[model samples]
Target: MKKKYVLLFLIVFMLQHGFSQQMVLKKGTILDALPVQDSIPDTFSLYLPTDFTTEKKWPLLLIFDLEGKEKQALSMFVQAAEDEGYVLAAPRVLDSISLSNSIVKAGKVLSKVVGMLPIHRERIYTAGASSGARFANLVPVFIKDVKGVVSIGSSIANTELLNVKRPFHFIGITNKNDFNFTEILAAKKVLDRFRFPNQVLLHEEQTEWPNIGYLKKSLQLFTLAAMAKGFAVRDSSYIEKALREDIIKVNRLKNAQKLLLAERYLGEMMSIYGAHKNLDSLRQIQKNIRKDQRYRTMRRAENAALFKESLLKEDYQYYIEEDVITHNFNNLGWWNYQKSEIDKFISGNNIYEKEMGNRLLGYINALTEDNIDIVKSEALIDEDALALLYMLKTILEPQNFDFYLETISLSSKNEDFGTALFYLEEALKNGFKDSDKLYGLEGTALLRITPKFNALVEKYLKDARYEIIEE
Candidate 1:
């Protein structure tokens, strides 16, 4: 009971006297560490613009990076928020905490931020990637005053909860080969049907993270939304500049003979900027694009490709779920066969099929990693499921040496040298050449000294760190 009052008193003190301390954190630089809290130390990363001051209220962007990668995420989001004169806050949540618990902790950190700074009540926003992205979208559903969401690598948390009467601007940024690519697009379609203010930004290729520019564009979307909704004053010059940049990007795609890309890009611009900026020029580009049979054919082809991608994704999800439950290591052959099919499409004559194939690979890997995180972090840890994932990782990505080493380490830690030895051999066979790093791996001391391990290492590279011995 006393602890509760102490917490409350600390909160009150921070609310009343947060700015009394010298604001030593540099303006442009990302303070990747936790704030100096006088009471409870909640881990959070913050970025204040160079011109930041407590005199005026500022828009705030609360970023949630579920993996506790505060520094990297802060760096990724800082530029966009700084450019748009918004404060960015990213909290460090642990894997041990339940989702609900983390959300509550995040709320506490946000409250501390609100207490410390003068935040524009109407312009509070949230952004994140993967599960964090989904969570960011879900925030406004439960909390008040979140005017928008910038979700990278995901769709909205729930479409059913979307109310046109109280809608928040949604900006989705994803890569073409992302596992969530189709889902993100579908989310946009659902938002479109609801007449929800939303825009989907798709980038080229597969990447775990979006390029900073996509994020910058996403931040710009919020700025535009604030102006459009009268949360902030409208800036005609800024709108025109943004529209001009969008046109140049479209032209660049078209000039590169990427007419299909240009068409889609223009369509997205129309959705995002048609109402705010003068649409006569953008509509002109769309009219010209409609005249091209090449683009028309490509659109149909893309739809067909999407249908195929959806089926394969469903297959992956279904089989993976079943496999996780049954520990169907034998069904790895089926997964391998699916990979072969994906490879065929990757090398196919049609560009759409190739992209779809890459998307499948990306989707599978992402799901695999997510499952690994789940199993590794489970309350009753499923060591077998984790071992299975590491084994599957060796098969799915033969060249990625980390999985083999990790499997070996897990086996060694469990004092199962037979399993350890097998994976050690597999790692060497897979062309992992860094012997010193292998010898230097921590928690593999027992495995490292085995004659079998030494033999494998010596055979691969004569300079084995441990000498071979005969008993």
Candidate 2:
């Protein structure tokens, strides 16, 4: 009986060893397309810190890339995850899939990771940018154990779905030029009403990922929150280091005469460190800054800009709807004139107006894209509406060659060669020199070979793919 038991133990050991060998993941590297489960078709990309080991539980940041760039998304957080000693995982969820299905897949990936890794149940968080950020904000709603979210370039996906009892730490990072900037500020008010712990970080770029330093700061905020709540042990050195860094930033902002930004940072610092340490001094500084005449004036200007932006956005919404429904090609000139007015605001000396102008530009483009998607997704497509939107897109973003090409293709599809040829020449005038793409544009076989098309291509690009044979 002893001999038989020894043999059974040996067999069990071998089976366990074989299973481990099948997934020999390396730390400090990103592993792509790892299956969530043997039976499930979904896969996830993962990154383990260089010091990662099964000896202790580590925080896990589940990242989402709605465009399906899992590895790319993982790379953005890898440096911060490594420095912060956190595990990063990005599932293959995409915007192309239904939100419900994406949530199910993300839940499965989270479950699989928790089962396989030493993930701290209380330290799990979600993060993403833009649409992905919006999706990440929804993860805590559907999936339990999500302690926080690091949402970049967006706000909550649906405020109505939020449960106050299950509040998570929300860290939002956005820029003035991002169309979602004002929306995020408004969402902060909602979060405040729900009594949810939240912070909004502003960066100085258009709609894109925040600096990697901001990424690190976001994870640091999560760590601080964990310590404050007793979810993790307090590290005096870490907390002091973060506090010093923030104070230095505040001083720098103050020195630069950016009182509004300085006050905002000071307020954020007070919230973050208030539980960990005394913040009376920081609170006083914020109070003083707010009382300053220049700061108060700046605040008023910002509020005025916000109010004007809302009215302008409403006007844009109404005009766009009316134009799209009427297929009002006559309103194109009006749209062009509005672009000029926006340009004036952008170039004006008023910083608030400049920021508002950038936001409006981004908002209009997003609005146009949304309408285009809506029209295309309908059971019966409206080619005329699409063509108009595409033309408007070109006007809004003149350097964007894709919309010009799209307009040309749609016109060609409808056998509107005059419109097609007109856009083709316009595209060339706007420095679109892709003769190959023009030649290969869908529904433009005959259009591309036309004398006008070749002449325009030859005029701008100095080369035409096809020669029109004169009869």
Candidate 3:
């Protein structure tokens, strides 16, 4: 009887271990979105993590990166998901267009795929790198019921599209010597403007390409870190050994060359911002880095944007050298750059800000005006403020002509022709580079003006009473 009891206990143990109670989506089948009998497309590849099963309703995380055998990365995410009782269903965001566009299409495909699985619709999430980050950022915009997102190795912007009330966690992983540090700083500034919580982890170890297993490790921890915040997982079982080793190699283990790399990165950041000039925030950063005496530098002008950039960049570099030291990389040093811009805008003292606003509004007004008999409604733009938007839009962002034209068209449809013509004239007067577009818009607006420009043209050809305006 004792032997029988032992055998039963062993059988149950084996079952429990084999059928991991961990929550992960395992078993991925190629879910073709094309019609039945259609050939398989290269754009659609689905990966299921290890814990997927048909019996239980699982939460899902859709990864939207390019096709690389991220088998290890996917495995770590799966382990974390399983530990947190969630499923990971990463679809290769079809490469046909931008990640945002692909995400829109993926939303439909996601619904179809999840419908066939035992997935609960309430807790969907997304994460990606590079182009994938853009798609992951947009997933919540196009898909409903997503709880959060995790972005690795890149950043997400256009926060307006996101469910603002929902939590957004961003993690960026880059090397200490990365040339895009300035670009990364700029992106951080933009995110600060939008008030999103983000962290940048700069890898300090210099193993070169072949020796840099630490880079992968840092990325995995970043994934885990985001998973912890977004999904609320807290257990070692979620992080496999491979992940832990990688994290230790890059973060815990540091060498002299890596330390030098960290210093150079910090110096570059400090030089850009002249943070040593700021008293309070820079002082606080100094207090934190007291041990690293060499980081001290002379202060420069009162440029908070430059200062914040310098501080974050330098601190990130420090963290890279000494993984043991951790700092709030999310803090943009409590500087109010946006407020300063707003103040200048309010005071009408900042020329660039004034112009940008005027150009935008002017373009809006111009696009909205139509014929005298059918006046389109006034646009949301404040006429006085929009002059600057128009000035900047026409001069600085010439690439926006098409978009400006579209906005004008929509405004005209909803409102009048006169206003649209005014914007066209403003754009033209302010060095609008695209003459072809200007002529087309001008012609369209004139066609709908009072007294009928087309009719007048015909009458003028016969009676010579009206003269056409030529540019």
Candidate 4:
């Protein structure tokens, strides 16, 4: 009997050890589809730095990708987090779901991560881009312990929800040509009034992710903030290095004759390093930059452009609504004319006007997308309204073949072969050469077999899926 009991105990111990080994997550790489809870359907993606271990708690950045691209979003932050010695997690929340549901899903993932990882509770932050950025901004408001938010390509969704006592570090990263650029500046004022710690980092691209360098700076700011707040031990070397790099960036901008950008970055530097070091010299530099005649002139020009942009946005809003409601196909020419006018501004001599033009272009495209989503979600969908919007999208973004295909499909679905063929030809004119997609497109079975379709395909792509019978 004693020998049998000893054998059973050995078997039980081996099974327990095997299970624990299987549960260990690999370090230094992305792990996808980790279950939040076995009973719950939600999952998340995680990235651990190569040196990650349970020996000490590390900062966690919860990323939200509105398009459900959790792995992609986590990938954007992986290198930054690795260099910063932070843990990265992205919940499988999507824009298709309601805001409340998205929050719940994110909350579950946050809970799971906190439970599973050795996370620094006070150093927790959130990040995302575009609509995802807006969602990240809202996370701190609804969920406690989110100490900061790295919002990219967007601003706060609503300022009224923020509480003065619960202020979190808000780092907004955007490009000059992003439509949300002006909005972020406006939000900075509100944050200032509320005494919420905040900073905005501007890059030079149009409606795209700022490079990994900016992402690294954002995490660095979070680390600095944590040190200032006593949530993490201050590293003197790290703080000095960050300040030096920022100063170098400021000088580079000044040398490039980007006076406004240099001045803005100077102010941001003061905010980040104020708690750790003396900023008297930095403050003097900012004061001198503000006093410079050329800086004043450029600042005035940018303000004027911002004012004009606001008025033009209102005009675009009114016209797009009117056009969509009336199905005003005739106004397509007017839209094209406006796009040309904006193009001239883009390529014009005035730098501020060029940026304004880019922002206007981004604004109109975003407006169209919002209206499209609204029309799509209605109880009874308006096909005509959607068709007009898709047509407008083609004008706004001619090279985006998806919009052209959507236009063709919608027209074909309505049996408006004339309109369908017209758009199909326009698509081919714009260098769309996907003969297979055209042939396989839904509601295009009859249209694709038509002579006009085959001719346009053959003319552009050199091969038509169907032969023209010459009826």
Global lDDT scores for all candidate models: 0.80, 0.88, 0.43, 0.88
Off by over 4 Å in 3: 1-43, 54-59, 66-87, 98-101, 118-123, 147-153, 157-163, 177-180, 189-195, 204-290, 295-471
Structure candidate 2, residue pairs in collision = none
At residue 76, what lDDT does model 3 achieve?
40
lDDT of 3 by residue, 155-231 (tens): 45464464445545444454423333334456656655665555455554321121233334333443454445554
Report the error of model 1 at residue 9, Å. 27
Model 3: how far is 405 from its true place, Å? 37
List candidate 2 segments past 4 Å from native: 1-21, 465-471
Candidate 4 per-residue lDDT, tens place, 208-228, comes to 688889999999999998899
lDDT order of candidates, top first: 2, 4, 1, 3
C-alpha lDDT of candidate 1 relative to the true structure: 0.80
TM-score of every model versus the real structure:
0.84, 0.93, 0.39, 0.91
Location of the lowest summed lDDT over 10 successive residues in candidate 1:
2-11
Identify the superior model by lDDT, candidate 1 or candidate 4: 4
Which scores higher on lDDT, 1 or 3? Answer: 1
**TM-score ranking of the models:** 2, 4, 1, 3
User: Cα RMSD (Å) between model 1 and the true structure?
Assistant: 6.7
